[model samples]
Target: MLRHRRAACYRCLFEEPAEAPSCADAGVLGPVVGAIGGAAAGLALALVHGDRTVSGALLVFDDLRRGADPRIVRFAPRGGCPACAKAPILPSLSPSISPLAAPLRVTETS
Candidate 1:
């Protein structure tokens, strides 16, 4: 079944290296690579299955990387909200805040 193939791929890509080196050996880079690969795989799988299920699977992979509960990444906010244009900052400031909050701060000499 397709599920078996996916599991095998994940094992080969991620779990196999556990014996050789912990994921931490590569710093955060390993997980980021794994996540990008997993997302691509999930998108390909979605072409075969329903989009909803593939998206859910991608969320699961992302959550696994972050050590948190899984949830879908909504591509668009409800009602085309402008505020949603900002990136989701998981553990840091929103990317847009710097320009909006203190545009002149960098030029001010201390």
Candidate 2:
């Protein structure tokens, strides 16, 4: 779920403002819940086919947007050490993170 929006935000960061994009295009909206939901609602004005999914997707989007970051934890990497890898990057987690780049931070969960 996060990876998807991370990709979308990456697109948002790199896309040219004048480059008109389709609904399928990533970051045509910000991929952030506010942006995506707003776009979906805007499209709903024209009553597009998938606006319904937008609300459902937005629920997940809102949840993720509010959190710090999603993580994947392995119970054991070696010697009972739980290795953790970065989830997709969202700029909200840290200003140091580039919207277009997901900088990996690997550490032991234990």
Candidate 3:
């Protein structure tokens, strides 16, 4: 896995006005959760689309309240990793349909 601490990437998404209230004051509307979720989804979509520039990556936003910068940490599975070895390979989907366009549905699974 590879990680990149790209300030540009963070700025592109979560750079708010200096005068804006801190996340603590915003409660559920904070950038902490939204930023993390968006970054994860974007990476997943890039992989699904066969983007050569992307690989297994992690974006970490540790303490936003303290004004800490986001960091990306990369790691690789050990040799002959059992989970990786057993992971199923699924057929790639054609890039015609946009996953973001679909409405989200939450259902209980047993």
Candidates in order, TM-scores: namely 0.26, 0.17, 0.36
On a 0 to 1 TM-score scale, where does candidate 3 land against the true structure? 0.36
**What are the candidates' C-alpha RMSDs?**
15.3, 18.0, 14.2
- Number of the top candidate by TM-score? 3
Candidate 3 lDDT, tens digit per residue, 1-110?
Answer: 23233212222222231344444454545565787678678876776776635454445666644677556554444343322334522213424322222233466879
**By descending lDDT, how would the candidates be arranged?**
3, 1, 2
Of models 1 and 2, which has the larger lDDT?
1
State residue 28's C-alpha deviation in candidate 2, in Å. Answer: 17
Cα lDDT tens digits for candidate 2, 1-110: 12121122212223322433343344434455577567446646633543332221212234455754323221211221111123433446755443433334455776
lDDT of 1 by residue, 1-110 (tens): 12222222221222222223334443448666787688667766875675544322224445445766455433322332222323323213644322221222233557
Off by over 4 Å in 2: 1-31, 48-110
Estimate candidate 1's alpha-carbon lDDT, on a 0 to 1 scale: 0.39
Q: Identify the runs in model 1 with alpha carbons over 4 angstroms from their true place.
A: 1-27, 48-51, 54-76, 82-110
